[model samples]
Target: MSPPPPDRLARWLCHPHFFKVVLLLALVISAPTVAIGFYADDYVLLSYLAGRIPGSPPWYDLYNFFDGDALKLQANLVSGFPWWTDPGLKLHLVRPLASALFTLEHAVFGHAPLGYHLVSIALYVALVAAAGRLFLRVLPGATGALALFLFAVCDNHLHPVGWIACQHLLLAALPAVLGLLAYLRYREEGWRPGRYLGPLGLGVGLLGGEAALGGAAYWIAYQLAGPVPPGRAAGLRARAAAALPALGLLAYFAAYKAVGGGAANTGGYVDPLASPLRFAAAAAERLPVLLGDALVSMPADLTSALPSGPFVAVGLAAVAGLALLYRACLPAIPERERAALRWLVPGALLALVTSLGGFPGSRLLLLPSLGIAPLLAVVILRGLRRGPSPGRAAWPRRAGAGLLAAVHVAIAPLLFLAATASSADIARKLEGVARTAELGAPPRERAFIAAASDPMVTIYPQAILGLASPDALPCWSALSMARASHRLTRTGPSSFTLEPLGRTMLTGAFETLYRAPSAPIPRGYQVTQCGATIRVAEVEDGKPSRLEVDLGAPLEDPGLALLSWRDGRLRRMALPAIGEAVELPWSPGPIGLL
Candidate 1:
């Protein structure tokens, strides 16, 4: 007796060797990341591990890199905090498991970046495997394979995989999927060990990173909508057992708050414990944007490019459209697949809520992608089976499915490859900036950048230089991060007033990362650090318009080096004579990932 067409297709899709092909495709697509080298915060972490940065936490607690007092100290010592940074800013994260892994890797790999890249790639492969197992368990057969393919090819994973510091996302996601799978087994198959294993995985995920909070959403969703064992008492017991994981989440939160580990008084991150109302508002605004990005391929980073009003409106419209299409296609989908979506849709929504504590980006969509991938896969599969000619009445569903298939199947793979290349390009550009700074200026000179398009160019070069030579560590203080040309008027031998060619300062996306809008720097504010003094000389619309910098030496002093980003490289700028005015042109540079 032969099986039906659907069964035959399911067997073909689930063939043991087909999954290997998917894995291979993913590996090939992401292979470029292995050569990207250290980027952004990787330099900072490396310098701290090498004891080059004073007042840094011990190796085991390396991720606790920012706190109010610590930032003040670092600002004083090395000009670590940019001039625009808020004095009251507190952005601290505690990820012990990730720290421990870094410690071990540092011990073995030393400063070589290739070793770290290899480790990150290994973790990425493991995460992909875990996601495949998860899709199989929940959706099964052809649908599961399609989901795995969609997930494996997603470009969003590039950030976590390419950047060594972001491996915690992978670390958190692997156990999270496994934990959910274990919980499902315990409920559906009467497995005894899964009860404890489920919570254990959740606890480990918390240790991995705070992003693991997304895992708790799946547990909650399963408890609400997942299949229940036969009999009233048995079903009740299964549901009650699910609550055990919440204890782990509570313990994690309690410990995190006790250690004073959370974002505070910053617009970049909203701590639910400290400011519940603010967090709620942020989550609401971010949810639609995240959903639109995950479902219909809208870029979530558009929040940075577009004004809040228009961006949120577009995002809301996208979400509404996707919801309608999902509803239209629901009846045609198999009951088993429909059952999976019951929990997966809500689970993905809840998971997205967990990511709202920080800024919105596609990188934060990893856990949510778990639910999204299966949903998209099933819908695309249904559309393909129905063929293209389903009449005008079904045009909307056909169009929606076609759009999704085009985005995920064709465009996403290309984007994944481009993202890998972009990471490498960013690493190269940052290295160029570091090397240019190192060669152009005198050794041990106190360097102050007159103007740069991005803050990473100002801060990262110092860390990169420090890692190269700890004894002769480089010191750099940024005067402005506004993406505008500047008029440098030398008021005195040691003082100059820098007026931006544009209206205001610190308005760019990278600049605001250090100082959020909620805590704006007032005019007449002054700070002296690293042999230089900075004052906000004028204000425009509550943001600085001009900055006055006193270098503590004559304008032509050999010990002073004036640098600015130009033509894709950091170059030494000639100091202006006293009472002379010069225009410092600003050239846009690569906006590296954070």
Candidate 2:
């Protein structure tokens, strides 16, 4: 009998011939990441490598604008800790392999951003290609094909691909991917070829990074998922062998943490000895979100800003594609493969929950996809087939699957566009900060870098060094200034007090005071180099507000100007000096050139 329309359509779409097209699209979609500049934590990496962080000059009370009063960055420096004794570095979490890769890149590429982007893309592309092939091997027929396509296209969790600091996820995940592949081979080809390779992959993955360790659960899940052998003794032996990797990983983590091995434990982990309940609660809460982000394309971080019209299109497409592909792919999967998901599901859950002691970001989701991807494939197959012997899928079920699949397929491309836009946005902002530094920064030691154009709450390196160089580096950054933001005004104009927040000195050539005001100030309240501040009352809320009040003599006569930093471009307010009022009648405050 001729196959039904949906089944025929699925076969064509899931064909192996189409995989090359998906691979090509993956490359194209990810290429724009080259445009992204080094941002935030990327600078932290540079700072540490330069040895500026570990050995900050005694004179610097609080180093850099990014390092607040606490000297948190200074503490995480890997220099002081001996690896054999104390594995943890104060400033960073320990991921030796990932760190080594970044160091190697820097040695080769230096400050060039494009080189790092390319390297990451190359590695990720290879990983994706492997994933697609692996899916084809395990699941039967078109199910594997469809799953491979899904693996290639779906990259909503792409932090590792874009961010320099997040490459650990990719590094750790690669080994796990290898392990899964080797396990599949072992299941098919028996002892000699697959036995040693599978466990070796898993064990290496454990030491590579914490994300790598999540694969143990996947190993367990894979072994027990299918039909069991006739002998209980055989099953027990198989399970025991599978358990070795997980046990080794546990032993490694215990030893690593005991000596204070550096780990990415920001709010995610508390010392079990110190507070077990807190750790347990955090893991419990994070488990659901982690699974949700992996299986569902509904992560709030990336999607909140998405336009409604496109989102609806994405949603409708997913519903339709999933519906159609589910029917096409389901029957093809062997019953044994379907059982594999039982282990895959729990493995993914355990991997995420156990790995993070604190909150997990979507960037960390890439590793979990190893187990989740296979599990999701199994789910898709089961939902479509519905039973041991299947007839034509119901209309409602087909429609549902098609829509879901379409959303997944469509969103991948859309997310690629969004990531590109985000990278461009970061570059643009970095440029604006650079411009501001060129015009205003002084060739001096200390600088008061009030965060005038902050997209997020914390100050970034872009605000301080203009995204390049430490005093030690060959090239000096914009303004060639070491920026500090001593606490400034809060509340209203009356409550405003311009003074150093902590012990950190604002004694450089310029003491810039940045402010984001609630209400508009009357004329002459603050200086603006750009225009008359009298009408500065026209300034709106949540906008960047800067007033340049020149210090004629220490706290004496003041000259005024206004600076507006918007749209990743800056307009310097160079209004010739009007006498300064140290206190404003509610001025956004004066920002002086150092």
RMSD to the true structure for each prediction, in A, is 2.9, 10.7
Superposed model 1: Cα runs more than 4 Å off: 1-12, 70-77, 232-241, 302-314, 387-389, 438-443, 592-594
Write down the lDDT of every candidate, Cα atoms only. Answer: 0.78, 0.49
TM-score of every prediction relative to native: 0.93, 0.67
Supply the global lDDT for candidate 2: 0.49
**Candidate 2, residues 278-345: lDDT per residue as tens digits?**
56765544455444455557552332222234444444554445446544665665675666555665
For residue 571, what is the lDDT in candidate 2? 37
Please report the candidate that would top lDDT against the real structure.
1
Report the lDDT tens digits of candidate 1 across residue range 370-474: 888998998877754553456775777877878888889899988888877877887888888887763343455677878886645877888888887774545
